[model samples]
Target: MFKQIVFLKRNRIRKKSKLVKQVLLLSFDFTSLFYTLLVIGYFVIAIVMEGNIRNNIQDKIISIEAYTVEQFWVILTAIPIIYIIRSFNQPGVIFSTAEYTLTFLPNTLQQVWRVVAIERWIKSGITYLIGGIIIYILSPTSASIVLLYIFILIGLNVLMTLPEWKLFQQHLWLKIVVLISLILINLVNLYLKSSFLSILFIAILFLINVLLLPRTFQQIDWKKVTAASDFKIWNMVMISYVTKIKYRKERQYSIWQRLSFWKKPFLYKKSVGYNRLWHLYFEKNIGVCLKLIGALFLLLFLILFIKEELFFLAIAFTIHSSSTVAASLFNDRLRTDLVQMLPWDLTLFKQTILKWIYSTSALLLLPIIMFIFRDLSVWTLIHVLAMIFSFLFLMPIKIEKVFKKFDNKASDFKWTEIFCYILILLIIISNIYLEFLIGVCLMMGIIPILKKAEK
Candidate 1:
């Protein structure tokens, strides 16, 4: 019976592999190929440059190494958490036709659950292993520490699939316990100053996780687990480059529906009108902005108190953020069906959006500026305002035009977009008044362009 189950599971994996290959071929395009090569080139360059990049001011004032280890880890941890939250909110799970065929097999439920748990562990191991490799390359941590971390993560991943265990999710106390345990382990390892003891502790934890799994597996809620997991698999398959294919857009939640009355203030406002609608849209999705702003604040705090060498990078990030918020003002509003129904005068609409973008940018910028730049001159202030206003007016139009060109294609990072972002950063830093004038003139061109596009 076990042999049959193993054979069926292997067969399922092979089938999935074949399906993934077909999907990849179907989604392949010259543009996607171009972007893929560009990303590969970028990583190659980054790897080559990594050693030369300096954190200290004497090494090179404006190098990428200006970002500290703590900053990098914060950014890294935030991304997975955000992605997980997004996945949960917009589940795209679909029931597979192949699952019906599995019913003929004996003890199908038990076999299926175990197979799934193993598959999840393998997937998590791959992810953690890649992260470990990146850390090994980038950090000064000893190989032992890196290996221990990776091994512990993999063991924890397996433990998470224990039939009744909920992982570090859905249970606040479990999450706290896990977090505290990790902290204590690290603290003990730091104090002990013995690598052997550290390994021993890690092994003990791994054993505990392994021993608990059988009991947890017996208590597992298969139906609930499968229902949640199926959506995750479907979503991953649809978005993955190895299995990219168009899927129906996930249902979107209204801002009100997503946030309770107490929590809604971060993403809600009392306002009405076409002119005010853009701001309302921004408010509705302000959580993303808040997160970005919080990160920028952290960057600024680090630059001021810890490492002033990252000043250029901080400015670059600020400008990049401004451009992103500006771009969002159009992307969401343009896609919204109700935008057409609004009593929009194109001239007024352009002015309103431009102002809205500038306000959002300033909201993000002022604190950073006040905190970081102590010797702020009027000229510097004017230059910053002029540069941001230019970006506020120009970036959305450029993004809208470019996005329209690739509207049919999957939205993935492209080098062309990166170049545009680099251009925005350069424009901000150049401090050339005539360049700002040119940008203003470019804004005039987009007005008529947007007018025609809207019509």
Candidate 2:
């Protein structure tokens, strides 16, 4: 029976292995390993040239206190990243035959113990090897000292996982309580002076984690566990990609159609001249602006609430703004085609784009202003007025000339777009540093130029 179970599990693994390979092909660049090697090579070259400069800085700033703090920070930061990577890989075990073998085996407890032992061994071995390499590189210490530290770090990481693992499978409230307690302890540790007592407290926490591991392992429903693990892997690989594709398609259509709806209230009949032109523009690209507005608001809410981290907020904003801007440019490519067909000159195109920009910006900014301040401030009122003037007068003329002169295609990373993005970054940073008025003025100035360029 045991042998048959093992054989079936092996067959399952062979089937899933092919699926995993397909997932890898779809999800990641095949040349990622080559790219990683190239990046490592560059890092090594940079380190070789700059190592002396770093050494000099270290020499100047060297202190036992600083060194200790730095070491602690490195260890603390590493623990989470390592833990996540380890967890990501371990989901593979759920898809394996061992789970089934354990389920059908007469000595269920014994089979579970065997699986637990093997898992612990693999986890510990991999953690130690990686941790040792990192420590050796960073400190260039003797193997004995590195090995000692590696064991300590690995024990700490594994222990950290136990309470969470147990809680994840059992009572969620208990897990939350434990998590809160751990966070509180970390906070206390941060604010309080280092002492033997504090160290002892931390050691006890580690001990509790280690004690929970066997219990956590014993709680696992082997059959359910195997199925869940397989489902998780497949869900991540197939479901996530499919969901993303569906979301993109929906977003594109929603944005485009929403904008077009306003222009053509009654769609059945053919229109003429300016009406026809307006209809064509509306049908072709109105969705682009609507999409941008939706996206901007989405980002605003996400940054304002979802992520408290400043770095992530900055990254999100950059990506959100740049992609939206690129989409706007791509939409403009169709407008360029319309421009060739229209009796109106390039100036008319510039005016049309400026009007679109002004209307869209007004729609986008109103919600933000309303949300941030219940009553509009005098400065904000003036800023809005300035933006209107700039969009109508300054931006249209300047942007149209630039676009006509350059005639550059939209790309993932165009130099022109990069410059615009840098300007946007500067504006955001300036908003952080300067008065709101200055930031408003800077934004107002850019609007006209952007509008003109669309022409």
Candidate 3:
């Protein structure tokens, strides 16, 4: 039974690896593929011409100082911290079909649980070990630093798995506190003197966490955890897209309860017509809108207060917002059967979309007011207006077409969607006025398609 389970796991891994490679190869169009090969070829020629890559790399690395050791730890620590925080709500640990297969196998429940915990620890340790090794090479310091890296890695793995124990799963504040404490402990370790006692303390902490593993496993609501982690709809859909394997949930699961924060009363007293429609959707999915708004606001703040020249990058962000907002707006609507049941006017739908897109694009204008308040240039004004027009006039058509694709139950993403933005980027970098003309013409061409799709 163990051998069979191992074989199944290996097979699944191989299939997933093959599927990812195929999707990547197919995702590249001629233009992207050519550039990709060109870049690879250029790098290959450069490396061949350089004679000895290892020696060159060694020469480059010789100038580094011990201060960089601190920086290395910061970079390595920041990534997993962010990842754990982001996924705090969801414990995405997956075990194989051991629950079902257990009945037929000789392995007891405790044995299976131990196997799961050991497997998880090994996986986590491998990831941390790789990162620690790279950092050790990059910023060699006291031998104690190596020990510190090892302890930090194991400590994080323990902290991350604490959710499985159900101690902090539902307690948001408690989770935050524990995470902060773990971080503080790691930081303090960096300053500690190199000693056998310090190393032993780290080892003891790790062992205690290890000792807690069996209880963690026993305490877990295995059925619930497995159900939630095993067959997420989005994960299945993504894998199916790449692999052409229609993976479905083994057991039925209901949607999670809607968040209560957005359940406030409608914006207006008498919610009628479009007001009602917008309120219903927006209130239910306000988180998406808020996230996008916050990101754009941050960009605006940075460009205005911190660095003015970052406005160039801000323009790209503003352009990207069209796609982001469009996705958020259409995600639920396309799946909603009631939308098709209504006597919806095609023209009204288009106008409503245009209104929303324009309103969203207006947020991008806030940064330009800073320029106007200080010392404004005609070119800045022109560039801003052209981008606004592109978002208002051109982006809606692209968004509407995206809606049509969704309505038709086609693929969720397309290569052309990416290439279109690439084209616009090149044109904008060359000349804004020319981009405006091109945007106008593209809008004209897409209008008929939008109308047809809407109907």
My TM-score estimates for the predictions, one after another, are 0.39, 0.39, 0.45
- Higher-TM-score candidate of 1 and 3: 3
Question: 1-455, model 2: which lDDT tens digit per residue?
Answer: 45654565577668878766876777778698779989999999998797786555445444532464455533443354344333422432333345545556575654654554456556777978986676555553566756766666766655556543444353323433554454445444544544644567657767876687567556664544455455553454363564463211111222234354445655543232334455456556556655766677556545544443342234335344534464355346435765555445444544555555555555445334433353346643553354334323433333543454335542222333444444445444543454645655765566546544643
lDDT of 1 by residue, 344-409 (tens): 444455456666655645544544464335547764555455445444534555454535433544
Candidate 1 displacement at residue 107 in angstroms: 6.8
Span of 10 residues, lowest total lDDT, candidate 2: 246-255
Please provide, for model 3 over 191-300, each residue's C-alpha lDDT reduced to its tens digit, 9 standing for 90 to 100: 44334434554466467567766566454555655554555413545557766777655553321222343355546432235544655666567687757776886677
- Cα distance off (Å), candidate 1, residue 237: 7.2
lDDT score for candidate 3 against the true structure: 0.56
Steric clashes per prediction: 4, 7, 0
**TM-score for predicted model 2 compared with the true structure:** 0.39
* Structural RMSD, model 2: 14.3
Q: List the residue pairs that clash in candidate 1.
A: 93-231, 163-216, 163-217, 163-220
- Which stretches in model 1 have alpha-carbon errors above 4 Å? 1-8, 20-115, 122-150, 158-228, 231-244, 247-307, 310-313, 316-336, 344-455
| RMSD value for candidate 3 | 12.9
